[model samples]
Target: MATRRIISTEKTILDKDDDDISSPVAGQQQSSNTAPAVPMDVILKLLAFTFAMVVVPIGSYFLSVNTFFKGNSTYAGGLAAVMANVVLVGYVIVAMNEDQSDQLEAKKKAGKKE
Candidate 1:
């Protein structure tokens, strides 16, 4: 009996381009080339609401379970669920208001242009 060895060449070769990989320190104007998809204020609001969504539920669960619910997990869980829904509704309301403001600003700009 004879043993045979097998070789595989499945690796892919990638072409490197100068524009694809750039050092930010090397160019000062690189950041100004493209605007962010989401505005900074919008991103900040999203982050704040996301944090509230997490903290509000857990905090309410713990606090209410001991203080208000008298260690009744059922009531605590229910309160947590309600708090989560409240946070969700609040986020939606805030987003709607922000969108309305943006539309109003656009309308104002259009009016000025005309």
Candidate 2:
């Protein structure tokens, strides 16, 4: 004897009515916004500043290293490196400011949608 198979298709309670389903609510805007883009001019300026800090003092230290002991020479090189790092930090600050401005602009645009 051969057995027969049956297939059933039924809608669940959740699928009964489209109108009864709730949509997701929109998210709230946060106070701290993203920054805007940095201009090419500003980027070039920062790069120049960084290069100046890193190259000039270090070169000067190298030129004068013969006049000082190894310890003093190392100290001067370290100071130059720290100054270069400070310039790099300035770049970071500028980037962060740009991001904040961008976020605020985005929030303003989103507010308009509401």
Instruction: Give residue 87's lDDT in candidate 2 (0 to 100).
Output: 69
lDDT of 1 by residue, 9-59 (tens): 433233234434555555655555488888999999999999999999999
lDDT of each: 0.87, 0.71
- After superposition, the stretches of candidate 2 with alpha carbons farther than 4 Å from their true spots are 1-42, 56-71
User: Per-residue lDDT tens digits of candidate 2, residues 1-114?
Assistant: 999554355655556565344433365443555675867767787788777777777776775566554557777777667766776787778778978988999999999999
Indicate which candidate wins on TM-score.
1
| The best candidate in terms of lDDT | 1
Q: What is the clash count for each candidate, in the order shown? A: 0, 10
Q: What does the lDDT read for residue 10 in candidate 1?
A: 37
Q: Candidate 2 overall Cα lDDT vs. reference?
A: 0.71
